[model samples]
Target: MANLFQKIRKGLQLYQQIDMEALEKLAAKVDLNAVVQNVSKLDDTQLQGVMKLLSGSGGHKKKVPPPVDGDFYDLAELLTPEQRALQLKVRAFLETEVQPIVNEYWLRAEFPYELIPKLAALNICGVTYQGYGCPGLPNIMEGVLAMEMARIDASIATFFGVQSGLAMGSIYMLGSEEQKQQWLPAMQQMTCIGAFGLTEPEVGSGAAGGLTTTAKRTPEGWVLNGQKKWIGNATFADVIIIWARDVDDNNVKGFLVKKDNPGFQAIKMEDKMALRIVQNGLITLTNCQVAETDRLAKANSFKDTAEVLRMTRAGVAWEAVGCARGAYENALAYTTQRKQFGKPIAAFQLIQNHLVEMLSNLTAMQTMVFRLSQLQDEGRLTDEHASLAKVFCTLRTRDIVSRAREVMGGNGILLQYNVARFVADAEAIYSYEGTKEINSLIVGRAITGFSAFV
Candidate 1:
């Protein structure tokens, strides 16, 4: 026992003589992997003591990256303080009022009739117009509003687009002074709803060249005949801007047909795969009589109708950004909580790759649309500019939403996850506002001076 005590005393003295500073310098030169392996074998108590000692040491610790926002470029910062605040108000409304009811109404393929007044309270309809109860805001604000609405529910966004962009834009841009004074004020206040009737069962992308719906001048007024399909808000709108070929001039003209017209019938289309909350209709107009006073005075041909389309197509691109942003945000939140193998799946490399790719694409879309809106505000926007944005944004949206669904597995397919609806909605956005192929062709024709559609 005495010999053992002497040996322990010698070991303690030797330990006190060793300098940790000198050893640390030497440790850099040596393969400390052996030391790490030995230290890893230590029991919990020893490791805890070691960690306590090392906690105050000088090595810098690695930091985990922050969670990414779908607006990776922070484009909202470009807005004025007032506009940004308004943007938040709209976002809050969507998150609170719209988000809760969207999945329910979507499941039933019904519109929330109660929301019309609540939405009107925002006073954003006719957002870009100058007078007649409109907000007279900039084009960027209009695009931002569309994005906010779509982030929660694309159907509500579509409903608003038809009312604000397609219907009201046509009147604002092409209606007679009397026509504007008559419908613009009430419609801007949301007391009157409006829809656009341009697409037909036979003509979708060729709306400019091949409208089968016909209108004839009879001294009493004009008679409109033919069928209109996929008309948003048609079943309930107070006024519908129907574009039809004039039998005399062989030119397309616009007429504001009232809902109660005996010859005009709007039947709600059912069993739709997407945007179910939007009340799309198939309208059969058999000698639908529109008074001469209701005809848009400035609309002479399809070229006039294309003016309205040019303005609204850019808004659709912004809507695609919102859809992609919604899906990305939901999937990101899900990944942070969803665990696999006793760790967050987000910690895995592959999951992070998917997330990064989504954010990159989303940021690109947002920035592109931001510039697109800027060009519109500058009056530099053209058909090719808007079409290019629509084509790229909607196509990328499909990819983003699909990845969002993949990340959530089965929950991604369910509407409650917030991603499934976007997935379906993306499909519709892709085809609408001109399909990707058609829009691509439009851009192709612009840049190359070649018409590929033939």
Candidate 2:
């Protein structure tokens, strides 16, 4: 009995230690269950076969052809050299810099403020916007950059999206020249951080028509009174763009609320299961006053708010792609390394199916977002277009991450395997920026000429 136990343990260890190519060949020859069942009865020949499988005999030598990358159809080749270089540069940064410490920070639910200066050096903030020290690249560049960032860490990407896309976008789209001149350059350089507060505690989906936060006109300026929830970066942003309904006209207005305003207090929201690295805040505006000059000049109505949502929604889709891609890549690498029955699990047909399915979904999402950004760059994107991509990509991201975790088995649940973090963060993506149900209804409204978001 002791000898048999030793043999089984040795077989398991050998299987766990072998290279992918040898494991693949071994997986084809034996049923792992049968080996376990016959563990005690196995003779010398069987034990030698098991060891051969683990040792990469039977013509197993190469790295199993690089494990079928998730970018199956070479969609990245569509990118120009400059865009491709940027994507690779960001990917290298995430893998080398962020990947090592993100899990620890996430477990502690703390933001890595130290990474800000390093992130600023990437020079990607306000990427698609022109002027004021912004990159002013095409919209496709923005989507690609978001994808690269999310591919490494979704929380980091969300933090950047709030700062660059939501906050900077408000200023670029609605601020007067002086306002943009005053804020954009510093925000772009990461010298001053920013946040956008649009979702109120009582008015999330209904924010378009019904904002509970009210801005009453005062002789001094505007006295704002309302509560904003899930306001990313509000806790530490130097400036926050608060959206409130005007009490007099009932129209939504945006104000630049500085962090130190006496009436403006932002409390950090805690105990989040996902995107823990993003500093979500519950902002209370009790007579928070803003000068008339601080109000956005062009944002006279909710249509301007919708415009900002439309622009950022596409970036959200790219973030979903990144999250899915991250999970898929990690799962693929893990499966190739973890072994059972004297062979790597990835060599099994069923495991390969899971991997292939994940890749297919990830590839489809990448292609869809790439085209979505192209439409955005050409000035032809619509709300429905962005909504459709958001719906498809986020929905698919959930499936991809689940399969990724499944393929990892027990380790999938552990935060260190990488897929686990993606799985948790994918849930947040599923809920935010319009829930799957809401985004689908938005698309349904466009396609069927029917409103379904009751």
The segments of candidate 2 whose C-alpha lies over 4 angstroms from its true place after superposition are: 1-68
**Cα lDDT tens digits for candidate 1, 1-454:** 3453354456545655786666567678886669667666776666656555555543344335467467777899999998999999999999999998899999999999999999999999999999999989999999999999999999999999999999999999999889999999999989999999999999999988899999999999999999999999999999999999999999999999999986999999999999999999999999999899989999999999988998999999999999999999989989988889977778889889999999999999999999999999999999999999999999999999999999998889998888999999999999987989889999999999999985
TM-score, prediction 2: 0.87
Question: How does each model score on TM-score?
Answer: 0.88, 0.87
| Full-model lDDT for every candidate | 0.91, 0.90
Question: Which candidate number has the best TM-score?
Answer: 1
lDDT of 1 at 132: 97
Which TM-score value belongs to model 1?
0.88
In terms of lDDT, the poorest run of 10 residues in model 2 is 59-68
Cα error, residue 183 of model 1, in Å, equals 0.7
Question: Measured by C-alpha RMSD in angstroms, how accurate is candidate 1?
Answer: 7.9
Clashes of each: 0, 0
